[model samples]
Target: MDLDLALVRAFTTTAGTLHFGRAAEELKTSQQALSKRIARLEELLAVRLFVREGGVRLTEAGERFLPAAHEALAAGGRAVAAVSGAGPAVRIDTWGHLYAPMRTVAQAAQALGPVRLEPGPGRDWPSVAQALLHGGTDLGFGRVHPLPGGRDAGLTQRLVRLEPVDAVVGPDHPLAGADALRPADLREYTLWCPAELTRLDFLRRFADAFGIARRQDGPNLGLDHLVQHLRGDAGCFTLFPADAPLPDHAGLRAVPLVEPVPLYAWSLAWRESARHPLLDTLLRGFTETGRAHRWLDYAPRRDWLPDTDHAKLAEGY
Candidate 1:
């Protein structure tokens, strides 16, 4: 029996996402084409792979075949790279380019020197993890607290930065002129966020732990829009990583949140089975930079983190 690598790729990608449209997007193909490929693969294997009843799901065969599918695709990639005399460039993806994660990557890339790193489409954990699993992306930088897959998700991650969070307030805010503020100082003011209060783990936890009375979520138009909204609302403030670049606004001020400060965890993630010559260089770059800047300084007594993040950090993940 012969296996078509393309069909296998389609299968693996679809298996990773369990959604035809998303799988097609990852493969850069139309949904119809992707469905055809999957049908063909099932025909060739003489067994049904997907149960497309109400929603896309794997049949028993597909669940059993997923691991082998990944292995076969990886072998094919290695074969192509071996003969081509040039491996594919490592693709890295992230969200919020203005944040500390991008800064960490930029400095790491400088240390990497010659290995080409291309930008990938994944912006967060689920997308990034899918990309890593299906060969769309080689590496991703973001918070992995609520990991996309379980502990055995065939992925590896290391804590790269423990960035402190700050309160972004309008100039008229009471604490705007202060050098730093204790978490307790924010209890009286409304905590405004771009997304739903429940969706923001760090902010939600901070608000809960500090007994903040009111919180609100509004449209997340963009940084400029958020800045403007925040500028106009002097009684409300939002939290941002201290390193995130704020748009220049005389009416806006980013004051440090201290006295058991809130911290955002940043980690670099990649596939466990991944192999690249420059992987070591990438890790070393982050390690050296982290060592030089004390990026991972997490004092439990003087800081607050989400429960999941705290567990991971406590375990030295």
Candidate 2:
């Protein structure tokens, strides 16, 4: 009869603990199942592995064979790991308020050594697309507008994640305590945005889409400076990605939008001709995580806008 690894593992486990109950618990199986496996192992090997009495005890034969069983399990694990190791390092760039999604990209890069996660150098998608073309970054995660008039580009975009929109209200905002809000709910209140990012068409599109006209503007402090405005009687707010790594300020809150939730996507952007061995591993990690952690929990998939000046952004977000 062939030597059964499962039965051997069970026999060794029971022999080590000298208790079928304890061994079954360690193996995540029933005590009865453990007994069957140990019995089968002993039958195949033609030797009694343990003795059952008032208390369980390993037999002389079991003690002699214990080391071999442990070694067998270790060898199997090593073989699997060796066959699955990643080849080369992948350079990754993380950009925008899209943090939660790009986490998968970082994780994928960990397998490939020398992983670099930097906020890419670019104010918008077109600039980001330029970095890829210049041949410094292997992959970029940010917004990108397709060339106008169906023009050609060297980079490819893959929608990998959805970032749900949320309200970033200050301490004194009237709707701070509301359980949830809609974009139109902010129509009466003043919406604030930084001066530098004003060029992003999505900001204007979002305001116009909801018919909110009383918008205010702030300084170009930084993309991460939105947290500063949420305090000390600011009386205003701006839209934020619900899953972004927002600051834990006492006065700020990212309340979810409802009824007609608006969302933007985070896509993976890579150079068309760029080839690297570890690329597949990074992409596979991005794809698997994207499938499970989408922004829309209730729906099968989130809607992505066209790759336009006001409509671009992505997964591998």
* TM-scores for every candidate against the unseen true structure: 0.79, 0.59
Backbone clashes in model 1, listed as residue pairs? none
Expressed as tens digits, the lDDT of each residue in 175-252 for candidate 2 is 888888877788887777665445555566778777878776766566456566656446777877766666664558
> For residues 1-317, what per-residue lDDT tens digits would candidate 1 score against the true structure?
78999999999888878899999999999999999999999998999999999999999998778767876776777588779866646668885443546676777677666667776545446767766665556678877756433732888778788889988898888888988888889889999877655445666777888999799886556677777777788899888898878876446888898888898888878887764556777888877877778888888789888777766664332
lDDT of each: 0.77, 0.63
What does the lDDT come to for candidate 1? 0.77
- Candidate 1: residue 43 lDDT (0-100): 92
Model 2: how far is 92 from its true place, Å? 2.0
* Candidate 2 whole-model C-alpha lDDT, 0 to 1: 0.63
Deviation from native of the Cα of residue 5 in model 2, angstroms: 54
With candidate 1 superimposed using the best TM-score fit, by how many Å does residue 15's alpha carbon deviate from the native? Answer: 5.3
Q: Give the TM-score (vs. native) of candidate 2.
A: 0.59
Q: What is the lDDT of residue 232 in candidate 1?
A: 87
